[model samples]
Target: MTDERETVEYDSPTGGWGSLRGMVQTALRERPSAGAFETLRRQNKAGGFMCTSCAWGKPKHPHAFEFCENGAKATLWELTRYRCTPEFFAKHSVTELRGWSDHDLEHEGRLTHPMRYDAATDHYLPCEWEEAFAAIGTELKAIDPKSAIFYASGRASLETSYLYALFARLYGHNNLPDSSNMCHETTSVALTELIGSSVGTCVLGDFEHCDAIFFFGQNTGTNSPRFLHPLQKAVERGCKVVTFNPIREKGLIEFISPQNPAQMITGKGTEISCQYLQVRAGGDIAAIMGLCKFVFAEDERRGGTLIDRAFIADHCVGYEEFRAKADATTWDRIEQESGLSRADIEEAGRVYVAAERVIGVYGMGLTQHVHGFENIAMLINLLLMGGHIGREGAGICPVRGHSNVQGQRTVGISEKPELVPLDKLAEQFGFEPPRDTGTTTVDVCEGILDNTVQAFIGLGGNFLRAVPDQGRIEPAWERMRLTVQIATKLNRNHLFNGKTAYLLPCLGRSEEDMQAGGPQTVTIEDSFSHIHGSLGHRTPASEHLKSELAIVAGMAMATLPPNPKVHWKKWTGDYSLVRDLIAETYHEQFHDMNARMFEPGGFYRGNSARERVWKTKTGKAQFTAPEMLAATNVADADGRYRLVTVRSNDQFNTTIYGYSDRLRGIEGTRDVVLMNPQDIKRAGLSAGQRVTLVGDAGDDHVRRIGGLEIIPFDLPDGTIVGYYPELNPLIALHHHDQASKTPASKAVPVRIEA
Candidate 1:
């Protein structure tokens, strides 16, 4: 906790020699097995593995080095030579392993065999695959299906998710929780209500032709580095890239494409954002409403020439109410809540009005709050006013984090029965799927704490580490009757084995999956809804490791009684068979998926809103007119500062590659807090001083993390920034979006203790 704060100023733009050096350092540190780099070379290419870092779409003609620095790190981490075999587990008991850091737990390396927890020895002993499967099936059969939760992470492929969904449904439960529930679930709920589609309508090619793009609450460089390529090109082509974020992210200010040899050699980079507005944490709603208010004022001054009156009359509803709300919202209130001047908001509005085509893009920053749904709804209102919903280069784009999170949702991983086609699944599989709505990510934590959830099946994720209220979830996790984890590497989540827990090793995305039909190619859907095939070129880390598809099949085959319709063995042998079933279930969107997946750059699943086809209840694009405009995160008490959790450059979601945040001029530590200089001064604290952050958890209980060094930066007053998972404990489980249940990680109220 007393880690020294080594502030290393990184003056250069992101993605130049520094990025290249990071990639090289990652490769050297991981010490990957043979052919790892060779497999990485083919990433995002035709017949290549998909990078698991982010869901950024690949260009139609991908560069030779399509993978970014974090992508390379993910590949190397999976393909590393370090192995956590039974012998490794024998050396360290579960109690001792709990004392290890998350990085050390994963750095120990890939799990090589299936292991079962031994309570007497406090160690994980190697177990046969059959024994693990039987034990899981026996426990599952003993408990009511409603008492179990089937959780899927983004790492699972479309085939594996489809099979897993079917298995969970057949097992007579709708308790399916996924990573999306904690991230982009608000996107699904908001977009579906407004535009009748859950996914983004924009394609990767749209960025090239768009005249302007409005980015809200997303860090492009760290979360999705490959996206910098398109942004750099857009800047080169004179497109106005406007950004609204709490932090003055380095990537959005300027970017140098490593692919551009000339710029790299010259040490110069293209300016990314034409204007960057440092909005306060959870101020996106007010900021977007301010833009809408400005647009309405301009349209009135121009005699309605600026607003798309015809499009609104023909294709949208509730405009009159939305306009009334915008007209009632005053400039003084907007400026105060958004932490920006009226002139700045108007200037950004002028940029929007001048552009012929624009794309409204966002990330979890907008979707992980109490008013998450409203935040996105207001953005949709802005886009609808400009007629940006259905156009060649204009639409909504939610840049997802995980590689296959969207694909998993598309393939029927959801807690809402209404979102997925339950009837079709039941009819196709010859069993009635549970129709009742199921538990979400937050609900799962509550269920576990109450001991109502007896068993949990994790497809591929560190569930305990990723979710909020980690301090509460860990002990309850151990009380469960059974826990099954299908993963590739060792993580902190693997150590918390319940009464009966099994760790099943599975193939990574960069490893070969030789089925009975020969080498297999799995499919994943990007943030843009483009479906592409991924085939690993590298060998499997261990001969005993099974494919995720196989592991799900093994659990299902062992649990369920022999059914005439279901063929688990055949489906596991050939993934295409699973895809065919998916085609039948989601016929309109994924019809002929097998054939279309082989097409050039794959194929888009198609968005209804993109074609001006609204499938909402009103049969048109809908608009939400909130009664009032306010900042989602507000100062309820004196000295309470708004805290936003973020990931470092060297880390992905819950996966830490290194301790440094190179882009932010910090090195050798992730425990430092970035605060505004004025705020630090007001709090009677100085830079490099260690402090504790206590959350406003709305109860008598104290939730705090101590020994975090404070580093003064250029952030807004009453706003501080810290790393995620580390700060997750301060965020209460109930502090989340009411509609989506995504934890409000972006805006938690806390006070500093010197």
Candidate 2:
């Protein structure tokens, strides 16, 4: 720990020697130094692996050092020398291991072989790959296909996810829920409805041309460091970057590129945000509404078409409806709900209007709310009003964290079967797939709780930690008839064993996957719609480890009765076959997928929104009057604070890199809650005082997470922040975006337990 007790620093920029040192320390600790360096150099480059940590698009012209700190961290972690062999598991019982932290569990090292939980021994014993697959197959085939859940984590490749999705469909189920359900599901839900696609309209080149970027509820620095490169360039080019979040993030403020040798030596950084707004948690809709009101009022004042009347008339719908809603939204209400003054919002509005090319960027902050879908709609509404869609430098950018969360959906990893191209699937696979909608993340969790869902097959991701209300979900998962996690590293999820649970070890993105057709390359879709190939730069962590693609294929072959139509062996042997299947399915977007994947930076999956062509029912980019659900609920409740779950700087999704959040000046702890000093005093508590957070959303289900030490933080008066997974218990499982079924993890009504 730093000598400075409870240290808090401000105005520090992200990246620098610190990031370099972090990368080195992690590498030395987890993997061989030489191998780690080679892997880092190879990240997101030609003939190297793409980072699975974030889906931030790559630069067209690469820098000397392409990868960022977290990307390096992810690389080192994936290529770790530490292995959890059978001997390791034999020493620790599930109960004993359950007491360990999520960090300690993963840090114990990667699973080296397929292991099945032996109830008699209370330990995971090594099992033969084929035997393990046979057991999993038996469980899947025995259970009702509708009751079985195939949970993808978005860490898998497009080919792997496609095969998994197909396997599930062939088995007659559409329960293809993924990590996107927790994060960018709201983005998908909004984009699909508004623009006829679920991906961002902008490409990486757009950043070079965009005049301004309005950052909504995302900490791009920590979550996506590669973004800082372009963001810094934008700042240097006099482009505006505005930010809105409860707590200010260093990445949004300034950045010193770790890759830049000059900056690394000089310790200088670049400023990013021209304007920063400390929006209250769940206030995105109000903030956008405020921005819209200014734009509308300005156009009215000008009377000579300041609101892009031509674009409005030709390219969009619901203008008058959205405009009236914007007008009806009072400045007082906006100020109160958004925690931003009318003048400040108008200043942002001015920036928005002045910029000819504007790009709106957002992440879970805008989408991880009860009104998350509405928040996205409002953001899109802001873009549509400015005629920002389908332009070279303008569009909505949904910054997905997982490498291929977007690709997973593109390859048919969706619960909504309506989105699936059933006619193509039937033509290609000869299976009349079930048209019925299956379980989503929410439904799967509900099913687990109610004991309706009996079996679970997780492709990747720490499912239990990532989900809300883990306290309830974990035990429910333990009660399942069968659970299989095809994973690289051990997580908290692995500890919660079902009656028959199996941990099937798989290859990481950095590891080589050699099948009958020799080494394989997988495809990942970036935040932009660019589809690229990633070739592993390192050898396999263990010979026993299988590709997620092969594992899914093995299970599919074993589970399904022998059929000529489903050529599982062929797909397993040659991944190109899987790519061929994708190309056959979505011929337009993935045409010549395997061939195009070999292109320098892969190919862009065609998004209709990018061409100003909306595939909507109304045949235009439809403006939406999103309900002010968050604003209506922003009324101050006595003894309550809007507690928002956030990630520490050292974390990636549920994977805690370490205990420190360097940017936040928080260290050596995960038990503290970030609160405004005024709110602490209002609650009759002092800084460093401990309190129990009692969830107060409603009903008989009272959630209490105790022993949280309050640390005074810079944020809105009514908003409090806590690092997630620990605070996951405070969020209700059912509390999610109604349209997207995404957990409302950002804001929850909570009070000090009295």
Candidate 3:
């Protein structure tokens, strides 16, 4: 097939007229109601709905137009005029809709009614809310509680998440898994073990006081575009910015703030990173260790002045062992594993050493690996060596992709008992909550394959599309006895209906939710642990739609036996009661949630690390030192490229807004792969040649994808990049972080085929 492509070097800086054009184009494409413009004006404001995109923190005093271009796209996508009513489903059968692309399916617009699948007609027919709830309750009651899986997406509010978790536990099961299991589970595990906190220590204001910022594996351009303003401010103040990744992401290089009228008029952008180091995929452990090695050597040269000797002596433990491991690691080994030379690593290290206050930032690129846990641990070790954390503008920031992923985890959407506090939960909810561990995202897939998990309930996510090993999960998903999805729009996952399947529509975050107490507000936590309330001003898309809180409560009311202790109906009627209960459950952080949310920027849940009060067993910050220098295996000595999954500029999670990846200079296509120019020649392939990618998991799965055109670019010799969810099929379900169970999507072994 001939290549139909337009791949060129992206020259312009990120967030200039390009962003302005995107915002206007998306608004026109969605053709939202007149109220949509007013909705955009209030985004991220004190009394407005939170941007349903990345989990970046909102500023204490937000500007007039506080939302980013991508955030506007998300709002417009939800506010589209098109509706997927029962009439639309009648026209297209499930068998036929399965052939539709993901973007096409969702672009059809918001779901208007609760519908159930009809196997005879292969169509979804509208059903009453009462009937749908009764059917789900009957199926759930027939199965063992352990055999049902309750999954949630980060789009849910904290109140809804708290209710979802309580319902699962009350049903005598603890299998509650959400989006966090796939994204920042490694950060939660590593931080909890070492520093006694699972969230970042730096607030949005920290950017003002920092001397340097080091970025690893995070692409702020598409993932968290709102953060570019802070980076731009840091650069303007002469704060050193360094980036380490396999690809030179455009956002890290330069940015033009749309808020800056002068810069926007001039079309001039501020340069972001002072140094860009292209590290190999899954090589963060080695790269971080090299920084530690350099710091240790510099301290030796300065007569022990470079390292924070006093802070280390007072606040940290296990330093001697970590230093010894760094001393023993050879420069040649570090260079080989990191895909960076000694001089480059040292040059980056010099910036870290010179800055008294620094921030280390990263995203899924570092966490979605086989040794993801160790990668986070090694980063902590590097910060501990310099005593960089717990100070002004100095800490570790794990940039979350979803809007409230961190908030969901903060409010008991976890499979682990330790994270959720099962014992206290049992006391409050009046049930014997299960003490045993529950299934994670990976475990849910395994259970479905084995037929041990017979039922599935999803809250606002396309589970089947976002997971790995789609070939294996898709077939197993059909064998389930029952599946219920509470969502706003129709996606590919909704098409794979089980024997008894129901698609229940919920209110979007941009819509006003009216309860008995009047229009209610829901709260979400940002990446920095700032808890704030989100209030929507627009009208509902359909009169039949219900809020997520009501749907979760309705499911619980129908499924569980009558119990006076739990006020399911009343709690849903007045959401403030839900917040009160949550406050009772977690008194320390959420004592007065309702009142505090009215304050500007809400409240900050102070980090223990920032207070210098460690919650570890030893009562101090701990340094993790593993015997081996590299956490995970690198690329094969033979010729094989490490596969890295990425997202397009116009996408959020699995939802595709458009086909254009503006920063990469690709348009109107997703079926393409970016490869190193040298690697393409070695594989006997030319640029723009249609080729296939075969997975090398050392198994008999025959995991391969075809019809992908190759685009040559300047990157590491043995690395290739492809869009996520599309390339998820190549990653084995079992290939995940052993400690956190996050899929190692960053460094899958693969080969190119013609």
Worst 10 residues of 3 by lDDT: 1-10
Residue pairs in candidate 1 whose N, alpha carbon or C atoms collide under 3 angstroms: none
Candidate 1 has an lDDT of 0.88
After the best TM-score superposition of candidate 3, give how far the Cα of residue 389 lies from its true spot, in angstroms: 1.5
lDDT of 3 by residue, 137-241 (tens): 999999999999999988899999999999998897879889988888888888888899988788889999999898989999989999999889888998999
Overall lDDT per candidate, in order of appearance: 0.88, 0.85, 0.88
lDDT of 1 at 267: 90
Query: Lowest lDDT 10-mer window, candidate 2?
Result: 1-10
Candidate 3: regions farther than 4 A off: 1-7, 629-631
TM-score per prediction, in order, is: 0.98, 0.97, 0.98
Runs in model 1 deviating more than 4 A are 1-9, 631-634
Candidate 2 whole-model C-alpha lDDT, 0 to 1 = 0.85
